[model samples]
Target: MGKGHTSANGGSRTEGYQYDINEKSILGDEWCSMYSTTAPIKFEKSHFETAMMHLIREPNINSTAILRADILREAVFEIEPNGKPKVKEEKTQDLEVTDPEAKKIGIDDLDVRVAPTNPLLNLHVVIQIVRRIIPRNLYKDAIMNQTCLIMNSSSSKPSTSLVVYTPHIKAEDECPFYIPHVKAVGILFHNNVLSVHYIPFDNVELLRDESQRAVRTAWRLLQTAYKHSMGIMEGYEKRVNHDQVVDKVDFQDCYIAFKKRYSKFLVDNWAESTDPKKHVFEDIAIAAFLFELWKKIYGKDFKEKIQFKDLGCGNGALCYILISEGIRGKGIDARRRKSWSIYPPDVQAALKEQVIVPSLLLRPHPEVRKRIPHLEHNGGLFPVKVAHELIAPATIVYSSEDLLQSPQVNVTEFSPDTFIIGNHSDELTCWIPLLGYPFIVIPCCSHNFSGERVRFNVRKSTLQSSSKSLGNSTYAGLVDHVEYIANRVGWKVEKEMLRIPSTRNAAIIGYENPFLDQFPTQEVYDVIIEDGGPDNWIQNTMALMKRNPRSH
Candidate 1:
């Protein structure tokens, strides 16, 4: 080990011989002792090879590579046979090398252009890679480079045991104290025997518990992933399952920028019983997604073209982020949260405390609150006084004309350009799509139009399409139901399983409502009055408002 970094596996890496590697560039522990997997060792080498490569491309799949930000996952690129990268050039950073001659290595440059990083294999298919890793919180955007070598024998049955290797180039001074410089991971596949071989860095005395555990977990992830790839385990896929709706890079950049500006403010000062990190970070991610989504739908001038109204805005963190980012928006909640006071005056102003009453209940035909219907014969009447509308069959229960005329009932209509955000808006979830304005609603706790908590079911057909058997969970059912309502109301709905760190991250978006011209929403009216209408659902919502936090 001459002046560079070397592993305990005896694969000494001298700064002078760093580029001198070739077919002799080994992967596993030359000392033949370190770490290895125990169970699930029996697997075909071919299947294991595919899995090994997949894991190399995405180390974060097993959720053990958490010390860096997308380094081992998104940033790594394959070095093609022609010495060019397979990844887009714009996404890569300048490669690190002390030798200035690396870029201009010619035929006379002593075979320095390839080898170790691209080990030679005469008959097998060889894969060469240059990987990078950046510490998550130690220093922002600081990148460190590594390399991987995969040489697969075409006929696994005829070959001896093959040890695939991906070695890390350790940087002692640059490495975070919380993470190790390297964990030389090796894999052996021969005659139904598969085991991971891990070699800790040579300086075991300098290693910390955190870094050691990180390395241990890394090898475990390899074993688990290999088994899953061989169909020996179940669902060993990527951990953070973000949907491919918006550009991931754009979303991640937005999140990082937003977090840098607001995470401390929200987390340090949070007053809710819930863990601030979860709520704060999740909201930040959602805000990031919204920024990207709006930009996609309305171009770069989305903030100038659209104004948002976030219903059930809870702690108002999302509103704070959007407003701070120069997007004009207001967040309304049934009750004001303690965290709202920490925001600036302008941000605070964007949060309102008000219960929602859809225009359906406010547009009056009669004074139904009195319960004595002066014009009812046998059916389809406003019925008796109840908070949650218990209609006989088909009933639209949220609004009225007499109440608008009355000072007690406050009904506010949105402008044609208004964009509604029903984020965890409970009762407002179902109605957000029905309103003429476009909306993005994330259903949290399931609630009917009457503000009553109800566990809706996923239609038998929809359960199959959902990632989960949504029928088993109330939250998923509500998400599906909200989309259903939007579709019924002549709105072309879209859904994004948001990248936010919350399970209830499914966002149903309806940016284009074809029924905008149909102001009365006669179609919504028909849905409300289905099967016979609520027995007393007509006036139930308004009457029940007296009990909940959303009282008008």
Candidate 2:
């Protein structure tokens, strides 16, 4: 929506029509001015039609933070036998376009086929209007309702297409470089060319200077949408479907309230080496997600239904936030972090130090723990036996003592009600889904089944699903790899692309469906064992259990 107007001098030539669009007479210059731009490239008629529809239905595609759009009414006009045009089908409801007192200034005349009261009445024209609602970014209390009108021409000869503008322009309505600013901005596809016409009240400068350039850029994008055979909101519907996997409204409300209470305090006194803003907001967002998820799963009384175990929880911020909100949970990591002391006593108590040796890994590996070889009471350990040559090498063999005495949680022993949170849990990320407990794992830097940092290669079949270009090195690939593993097991998985400050925001959730009897089955353990036996990992994990002098 440009501020200033160009002098209406040259009439535009309609592609197949014999007559030229007389600029001076078509748009009367009594109380306002106009600015127009034209391009010679031609576009498919459908391209023009689809773009117009997107401009109405999903205006947020071209702008930022626009809340919603609703079509108020649609009026289709047909040329009468006597050359005049009358409405054929219309749903005026409360918004009658023909109201004389409304002062809705629009196209004054059509120098081509329309000869009646106005060009909007041209034969086969559909006058569609939408009420766009946008909330102010910094000032949420303020909102604006701007009505956009789109008139598309008949599919027959002349080939002149849609024209976009506001229903009215008031001099006193001061606004930012927002679309249809103050007055009306028109985007027209006519005569195989693209054009932009801005109308401003004669007394007001409207959105000038910076707004001038912004409006030009806005129209240019509209032109780009037309030039290519795509809608500006091409995948808008698809995106909404993908994004709504979680309850967005509830998540947003929870996240904002949590951030307001905790962000400033944490950022001011962060004790970690990572960026405070990144870590703090991420934890806040994850905590918010969990709160909403727990509510849906266990109802409002979710606090008593289950407790969470966060394996490899970094910084313990997420545990702190959840515990502060009255949810009982614990954060376990390989080494204690300095940030633990910054939290209150409960969060401090919840943060425990130890490496996670999944109970599954400790099952078959007797060699993993030789029961303190130097201890006098301990009998000489016998040589391990092999069940089947293939299964023996792949699986771990450990006695009941290893399960009881070792400083690691046994996955099989956890109560069925435990909910696991794997916030960048590294080596444990893949194991969370397999642990048979309902869990959420957010993948960060690439890591294999072992904590040895190695990028997971995306499978060929998965790569071609939606993102054919998904490379092995990308975070998307890593997230997809986790999803693949979850699907390989029998657990029904739900994924949500979280709204956090960092790029590591994909949350993969696995659970047993309550309505349907669907729980995870370990049908894919052969391939899992082939990846790497637990011997190397067991030694590496045990090394971390040695205490580091606590950092102040």
lDDT of each: 0.58, 0.58
Per-residue lDDT tens digits of candidate 2, residues 88-165?
776632322222322222223111222121243242345545352333231332233445544545445556564545
Give the lDDT of residue 1 in candidate 1.
19
Score candidate 2 by TM-score against the native: 0.69
lDDT tens per residue, model 1, 220-297: 544564556566334344433454568765786667678878999999998777789888988998899899989999
**Root-mean-square deviation of each candidate, in angstroms?**
9.8, 10.1
Worst 10-residue lDDT window for candidate 1 reads: 104-113
Off by over 4 Å in 2: 1-37, 55-60, 64-141, 160-180, 201-241, 298-301, 364-403, 406-413, 466-477, 513-524, 545-552
- Give candidate 2's error at residue 222 in angstroms: 4.1
Off by over 4 Å in 1: 1-33, 38-42, 62-125, 131-142, 158-170, 176-180, 198-201, 204-215, 230-241, 364-399, 405-412, 467-471, 531-552
Model 2, position 205, has a per-residue lDDT of 43
